[model samples]
Target: MNLNESDMKVQEPRLWSSDGWTARVVKNEDDDGWAVAMTPDGASEPALVGPWTMGRDKKNPKPLDQSAFLTLVKTAREFVRRSEQQLHAALHQSIAVTVGTARVTVCLDITPDEDNPSATLSARDEGDDLLAQVRVPPSFKLSRSSAVAWAEGGFVKPR
Candidate 1:
């Protein structure tokens, strides 16, 4: 298929799009400054948006260039990665404790649903074999004392 020049990568003064990312300079809503938004291809919203450099006149935004676009891409990718990591950490938690003379690791995994959010509390022995697993409320708090208490209580489903 023939692609027109406009359909190809754009490198305008205020807009740049290439390599699965687009950088657009827009007016800041909170102030007179300019802001740049970095959006990945196929995404409706920008993953990163921050202040942009002002032009020599200090009235207009600085032109978008190759160097600036690349920097924005890198920063935006890192920002997305960090956000994913934080969400993963919040959804899954683990702690290790001793049950009798053997070591065990307890984990809590949360499944977020609009209608029925839920969580699972599971334990694994030192050999990584599943000791027990039970459904729990999403609000259940996992702590060292709680884990130890559960283990000592014979791994029964907590009340």
Candidate 2:
């Protein structure tokens, strides 16, 4: 049968869509229980997956409802938000170092990509003016001592 746009829309009972999220109930392949997956709009995979409530018969999963779907969307959005915050903190780390009478800030920004992985070490004065920046290997670690050394060495690239 030829399917039109309206006909192609999924009408499965176990799947529900909300503002920008979708809740899907699937059987847990690892066990007899069921699980629900929450995926955000435009995302390929679910951002949150967890055990779901069982139906009265105990064989099938409880059907998705407005309350459950709303809760799942809230939880999945928070999970994605926290994940992004953690990744941002890891990628951009900074520390303050005391050099002479000025306090300088040293920041290590890392860009991780499969094709090209790189890191940059940058130093800024107390007023946040750029002092020196150099590209370093992705594996380079930033520490208080390293920052101090960089500042003491005239903001040169650390060995």
Candidate 3:
């Protein structure tokens, strides 16, 4: 093999490749360098929105190319969609335990010993408090009702 005959073009792999996740850079709200947002392929919204975890620097954001962006969008979109779906499935099925300004829904999935189910419910505020926990038959019954009830704190505990 020739050591260095002439100028050569080197290719590279996309950023943040996982089993079902991807990430890329986009224009920041400030409209300066770049910020990263994750979107699942089939979803219309971004799954995670934060300073791009896998970018170049604080000021200079990595270039926004099609290859990387597409992958990122697909992965992120799927993540968002699945998360939403899981939450939806937990509606009336999970258990409910309201606490504080936030509503925590604990969704338990597949298990013989309910003491520790397979998965947990989604949706929580800044503070991790138990708002609602769904643990049986999986339904979205507590979506809004629980929040309203918790806010008022007028309803007595259900027997």
Who wins the lDDT comparison? 1
Looking at model 2, residue 23 earns an lDDT score of: 84
lDDT over C-alpha atoms for residue 82 of model 3: 95
Model 3 spans > 4 angstroms off: 1-34, 38-46, 50-58, 94-158
TM-score for predicted model 1 compared with the true structure: 0.92
* Tens digits of lDDT, candidate 3, 4-89: 32233222232443334445456677756556766443456557865543355555565556665565556556676798787665
Over 6-91, each residue of candidate 2 has an lDDT whose tens digit, in order, gives 23333256998757777899988899999999887778899999999999998888888887888888899899999999999999
Minimal lDDT window, size 10, model 1: 3-12
Q: In model 1, which residue pairs have backbone atoms overlapping below 3 Å?
A: none
lDDT of 1 by residue, 63-140 (tens): 999998998999999999999999898889999999889798999999999999999999999899999999999999
Q: After superposition, how far is residue 70 of candidate 2 from its true place, in Å?
A: 0.4
Error of 3 at 106 (Å): 17
- Per-prediction TM-score to the true structure, in the order listed: 0.92, 0.88, 0.32
What CA RMSD would you report for each candidate? 2.3, 3.6, 13.9
Please give the lDDT score for candidate 2. Answer: 0.87
- Candidate 1's C-alpha runs over 4 A off are 2-7
